[model samples]
Target chain A: MAASALSPIRIDDPADPRIAGFVSIKERDLTGRQGRFIAEGTVVLRMLAAAHHAGRGLAAEAILLLESRVAGVEAIVREFPAEVPVYVAAAPVFDAIAGFNMHRGVLALGRRDGVSGRDALIASLPASSLVLAACGISNHDNMGSLFRNAAAFGVDAVLMDETSCDPMYRKAIRVSVGSVLTVPFAREGSAASLIERLQHEGFAIWGLSPAGETDIGGIPPAARTALLVGTEGEGLPPAILESVRTARIRQRPGLDSLNVSMAAGIALHQVALINDRI
Target chain B: MAASALSPIRIDDPADPRIAGFVSIKERDLTGRQGRFIAEGTVVLRMLAAAHHAGRGLAAEAILLLESRVAGVEAIVREFPAEVPVYVAAAPVFDAIAGFNMHRGVLALGRRDGVSGRDALIASLPASSLVLAACGISNHDNMGSLFRNAAAFGVDAVLMDETSCDPMYRKAIRVSVGSVLTVPFAREGSAASLIERLQHEGFAIWGLSPAGETDIGGIPPAARTALLVGTEGEGLPPAILESVRTARIRQRPGLDSLNVSMAAGIALHQVALINDRI
Candidate 1:
C-alpha cells in the first residue's frame, strides 16, 4: 500500500484562511454550499471514517485536532483506509475558530450530499421493504433519533415529508451516531401525496396515529409496509390520516401520546417483527 | 382577585444569597438537598403550576426572571394558585447566577421530594400494575426520555436499579418535560433482587435482551408485567437475564442495537398494547 501521503498542516492563527470552514458554529447555513458537517469525539470520527471506507461517500475533507489531541487523532487516522489531511492548531486558537468549547478536542469536516428526492429513494429500495415516513417532525434531534431507530430496526429507507427537518443538519447527524450517513433517506412531497403513491404501489401505509381505529398489533403482517409518524404536538395531518390505513400503539386511557421519536422506534420495531413473519 | 399577593423583588446583585440554589449549575450533590431543583422556561413553569393545582405537591419556593421577561413570569404567576414569591433581576445578573444563558429568561426553585426506595415503590403499586425497571442507563437524557415514555404508555412506575442515573437531575427533568416529576419512580437495589421481588409478587418479569431467544411480539399478554431495560452499549446483565424471562425486539441482522431510551419506549408501548388486549 503506497502511503497515500497526507501532510500535517500547522495552523497558528485563528483567522488563517485554511481554517475558515470551522468559524461561526452558530451559523449552520454559511454560503449555502453545504457547509462542513462536523463530527466530534473519537467514536463519531471513527464511524465517519468507516462510512467513508464503505463507499458511503462520507469522506472527511479535513481533520482538525488540537495540539494536545494529536494522539487520539493519530489512533483514529490509523484505521482510515485513505490518508486524509490533518490540521493541528493551538487549543485556544482552535476553540476561537470553532466557536465552542472543544471537549472532544477533535473535529472533522466532510462534504454533504444533497438531500435525495423521493423517486431516487423508491428506486433504490426492494419491492417489499420496511420504511419509516417522517412527516412534520421539526426537532432535529427527534429526526435523527427516528433515522437511528429506522437503521436499527432494519427499515430499508427513511422517507421524510416536506415539513421534516434536514437529516444532514449537524445536530441530527450527531444524534443519529452517524447512522444518518449510512441509512438511505430522501425527502418526499406532501404526506398525503406520498401516502397515496405508496398505497398505489402496494405499500400498506400505516399511519401511527393515536386516534387510529386499528390497534398496531392488528396490522395483519403485510409483505410491504410504511410507518408514518408526525410531529410532537400535532399528530398526522387530517388529510394523511384519512388517506392511509391508520394503526396505533395502544396505550392507557389517560396518557395523551408517546414522544414522536419514541413512537417511531416502537412502530419501526413492530414493523420489523411483522416483516420477519413474512 | 387578591391583587396578586406575591410581589416581585428586583435585585441587581449577582452575589445575592437568595439565588444560591440557582448558582451551582454543574454540582449535582449540592442539588440533592431540599429546595434545590431548578425549573427553566415558561412551559415547565406552567407544568409546575398545573402539578401544584392537581395537588401533586410541586410548589415553587422562589421564582427568578429577567427584568425583560417580567411579562411571561407574570402570566405564569396569574395561573399559579398559591402566593409564590417572584423576583426580578437584571438579565446579566440572572445569567451570572444561573451560570448559563437563560433563553427562557425565567427560572424557579422547587422543593425536592424524597425519592422512594424500591420497597416503597413495590408496596404502592397495584398487584396487576405494569412497571419499567431500568438498569445501568447513565445518560440523563435517555433516562428522562424513558420516564416520559413510561408515563405516556401508562406504566405504573419506573424503577431505577443500582447502576442507573438519578432521574431528578436537571437535564433529566428538562428532557422529560417534567414527566419525571409526574411519573412515579424509585431508585432501588440490584436488578436481580428487584426481579426476584417482582416475581414473588406474581408479576411476569420481561427482561429486554437483544440476544434473547424470545421475540417481544411472541410474549403472551400478561396481567402484570415488569419490563427491564439496560444501558445502550450493554444490554441486560447476565445475572438479570437469568432472573427474568427474556424477550428481544426483532431487528435487522447487521444493526448492533437500538438506543436504550428508544428500546424502552418501544417496549413500554408494546406492553401497553398487551394490556389493552386484556
Candidate 2:
C-alpha cells in the first residue's frame, strides 16, 4: 500500500491499522492523548496551508482524501509545502473512520498548540488596545464564533478564563473559520484575577451583565478597554463582576440576557466605537 | 403488532407502510413536502409540549419512544394534551426508521405551519414598539438565535424578509430553545418594501450596517425603532440601506463587522434602553 503509485495510500478495509488517526475522531477519550485535531472541508485545508507557509508553526500531520475527491485534493496539495503528506482511501473506509459522511472529501490532522499565558498575550498587544475576555464559556462552537467575532470586530486580543473550553478543539477551530489562528489569544488566570490585573495595567474592565446598573452607552470610550463576558447559564461570578466596571446592553423588560457570544459581539462593537471616530 | 400491550408496531422491513412518517425523514426529497419536522431529545420534546399547551395552535403529530426512554416518554406524555398521539417502538425499529441512533430515545413529528405574513404580525404588536426585521439571514441556527435574542431583549416582534430561512426548520427550533414559539415573527416582503411600509407606520427604521455613518448610541432613545439586520455575507441590500436611517454599532478600527445575529442582539438591547427610561 505504501508503494502504490497514487499519492494517497489506498486502504480498502475500514479496519486497516494505517487509518488509526481518522478512526479516533469519534472516540473522544483518545483525542486528548493523540494531540491531533482534524480539519474538514477545503476552506480549512487552505487555511492550514497558509498558516504552515507563514511559519505560524501549525501544520497538518497527514491529509485524508476520498478517491472521488482526489482531484480537488490534488489541487490543494499542489499548494501545500513540500513536507506535508497526503493519503487517499475508498469512500466507505473514510466514512467508517470519520464516523460521518465526509463533506468536501478532505480532512487533515494537525498538531495542537498549548495556549499562551496572560503575560505573553499582554506583551504582544499595543499599549492601548481592545481585548475580549471569555469566562466560563464551555461550548466549543460558541468559543469559535466569539473568536471569529473578535477578529471581525478588530478586537486586539482574546483572553480565555479558567472555565472556558479549548479554543483549539476541532469544532472550535472549524466554527472560527480559522480566525482563531489569525487572532492572538491566551488563557489567563481566573476572571477575577485577570480583571484585577488588567485594571492595574490601566485597562478599564467592563463586565457585560444584564444585572449591570450602568448602561453600555455610558461606558466612556477608553484608550484601553477589556470587555469581559461570562458563560450563558450562570453569568459573571459576583467577585469578578464587582472587580470590574459593570455595564448592561439595554434589553427589553421581559428579556433578561442575550446569548453570551452574541452579547460579547455587541459589547465589543460598542466598545470599538471610539476607535471608529479616529 | 399494533394491538400489542406495548403498542408495539412490529416492522421487520424498512419499507413497511405503517412507518411512512419516520421513513420520510431520511428521504431528502420527501422531508419538507411530508408536512412534518422531526424533534429529537427530551428538551425539544418538552418544548413541543409547551408550544402545544400555549394555545398557539401548534402541536406534535406523534411521539416515538424507544424502550430505554419509555419512562421518560411517559412522563412527557402525561403532561401533553390528550389529543397528541404517542407511539412506543422497539429500539432497533425506532433507530431504523429515524435513520440515526436515538440517544434521547424519543422523537416528535410536528406539522409544519406556513410562516405568518407581515400585516398579521404588525396587527399583533402595539402601535408603538420595538421590532427586529431580519432582512436576509440564511443560516437556520443564526435565525433561531436571533429569535431567542428578540425574545430575551423584549423586542415586540420579529419580521423576517422573503430571503430568510423558515424559522420553523428543526435546527432553528432547537437553536432558539423553542423561543420561536414565544417570539411572534412573520415574513415580510422584500427589504425595500418592508422599510417603506414600516416608515409609513411611524416606525423609525434603523438600518444596522457596519459601514453606516451614525453611531447606534446617537439614535434618539424615544423613537419606535425597527432594527434591520442583513445576511452575514452581502449585508443589507443597497435599496434597503437607502430607504432607512442608518446606525452602526461602534467597533474598533480594522475590524470588519459583527455576526448578524449578535448585531441584532446588541441593537435590540440598545433599543430597549428607551423602554427603561420610560
Candidate 3:
C-alpha cells in the first residue's frame, strides 16, 4: 500500500525554523500565540484533520510527529491540504523542541481565526437549541471538560464570557479530547452581557450553583435552553445567579460542591434527556 | 483568643526523623505507603481530623504545617487529639521536606487500617442503598472524582476492584476535595466478583459503557442499586460489560466517550434522583 500523497519533511535540528510553531510548547502555552494553537496526540490530530477537510472554520497550519508515528497517521495526514507541511523528528529533537517530554510525539499547529463571532454564532442557533455557557472558568481542564460535555450532549453551541480561559489552550484542548476543534464556541464579552444577549435571543438560561433553587432535573424543557456554569470555589456571581433561573443538583448536606465540569455533565445530560436532544 | 489547646513544635531540618513520613511526597506516592498516606491542604486535614474524632477507623498520625498557616487552621488542628504531634516549619524547610513546593502549607500523615472489608461494608449498607462500584479505574483524578460524585449523591459505599488505583493516593484525595476520607469504600476482589457479590446482595447493577443497551435515565430505580464505571478508553472490560446489566448515557453518535468521572457523576446523579437519595 502507498504511504500517501503527503510528503514527510525530516527535522534533525531542535532549532529548525520550519518547526518553530511547535517549539517550547509548554512555555508558549502561557504566552498567547497570536491566532495559532497546538494540537497533540493522534486522536486530536485526527479531529483537526477532519475539521480542516470538512472546512469547519479551523485549519491545520502544520504537523510535527515522531518519525515512527508517521505511518500510523498517514490516513489522517492525507486529509490535510498539500500546502500544510508535516514534520517528523527523532525523540531527542522532539523533546528538546517541546521543552518537555512529549511521549505522544504528535503535535499540530492550528488556527482559530475563522471561529464564528459570538453574535454571529448566537444568531445562527436553531429555534430549538441546547447550548452551554461558561462563566469565570479559568481552569484549563475544566474548560476542556465543559466542551467535551457540550459535544457529548449535542449542545448546539458554546458561549464563553471574557473571564473564562480560552478552550483552545493546549491542556484544555487535550482535556476536551479535541471536542474543542469540532464544537462551535465563541468567547467574548462579560458574563452578564453574554447572559443578556442569550436572553434577548429568547433562550431560557439556567445558571448551575449549589444554592440554585430549582432541581436541575425538574427544569421544564424549553424550546431554546442554555446551561450556565461558573468557576469552582465561587460559583456564578450572586447577581448572575439571580438574573437567570437557577438549577441545583441536589447533594448530601455537608460536602464540597462537585467539580465544575462534573456538574456541567450532569446538568447537560438532564437537559438533553428532557429535550430529547441526546 | 487562644490559638489552641494543642501545642505546635518547630522543626528546622528537612530531613528530621520525625518528619520522615512527609518527606519526598512525590517519590513516596510511587512507593507502597504501607498503612500510611499523605493528606495535604487545610480541607483534607480537616476531613482527616473529623474522621479521626468520629472513630471512623482513620487517624491523623501527625501534622506538618508552615508556620504561617497554623493560625488559619488552628480550629482544625485542635480537632486532632492532644497526643498527635503538630510540626511547624518555615517555607523553605517545608518545601524541602515535601520535595516540591508546598503552597498549601498543610500536610498530615494518615493511616487507613480501619477501612472496612468489602463484605463487611456491603453487609453494613441499609436495606435501601445507592452505591458506586469502579472497575479498572486507575487514574487518580478520575478515582477522586468518582468518590466526590458518590459523596455528593449520597452513595452508601464505594466498592473498587483490586485492579483499580488506591483512592488514598495523595492527588486522588485532593482531587476528591477530601471525599476519599469521608466516603466509606472498600477496594477488593476482581470486577467480576464485585459484580457477583453486589448481585447476591440484591443490588441491581448497571455497568456504564458506550455500548450499554439502556439509557442510564431509563433504568428503573431499585431498592438496592449500584452504578459501575470503568477506565476512560477501554471502558468496562468486555467480559464484565457482558456479565452485568448495562446502561449508557446517551451521547452524540460519533464523538468519544465522556471522561469516566464525568460519566460516573451523570449516572450517580440520575440514580440518586430516581432513588430520592439526593
Q: Give the best candidate by DockQ.
A: 3
- Candidate 1 — which residues are off by over 4 angstroms? A1-35, A53-58, A65-83, A87-106, A114-116, A188-202, B1-31, B41-43, B46-59, B63-83, B86-107, B188-202, B220-223
Tell me the tens digit of each residue's lDDT in model 2 across A1-278.
32243466777877777667777464552346345677777767777777666665466777888887777556666677656677777777778877877346788878756545687667667877888987999888799889877877788889888778877777787777777766777775787777767777778888989888677677887778888889877888898887788988765455436678877877776677655522
Off by over 4 Å in 3: A1-6, B1-6
Model 1 Cα displacement at A194 (Å)? 4.1
Show pairs that collide, candidate 1: none
Local accuracy of candidate 1 as per-residue lDDT tens digits, A1-278: 12223346888988988878767553653333363577766767887887777664466787788877776467676666556777888888888878878436777877755545687667667877888887888888898898888778777888888888777766777778777877888775887777767776678888889898787767777778888889888998888788888888776555557788888887777777767731
lDDT head-to-head 1 vs 2, winner? 1
Q: For model 2, what is the alpha-carbon lDDT of residue B182? A: 71
User: Which rank order by lDDT, best down to worst?
Assistant: 3, 1, 2
What local distance difference test score does each model get? 0.76, 0.73, 0.89
Evaluate fnat for each of the predicted models and list the values in order.
0.76, 0.63, 0.87
Writing each residue's lDDT as its tens digit, candidate 3 over B12-99 gives: 9988999999989988898779988889998889899888987878998999999888899998888888889999999999999999
Summarize candidate 1's per-residue lDDT along B103-183 as a digit string, tens digits.
478777787555456787787888668889888888888987887887778888888887787876777777777777777
Q: Ten consecutive residues with minimal summed lDDT in candidate 3 chain B?
A: B1-10
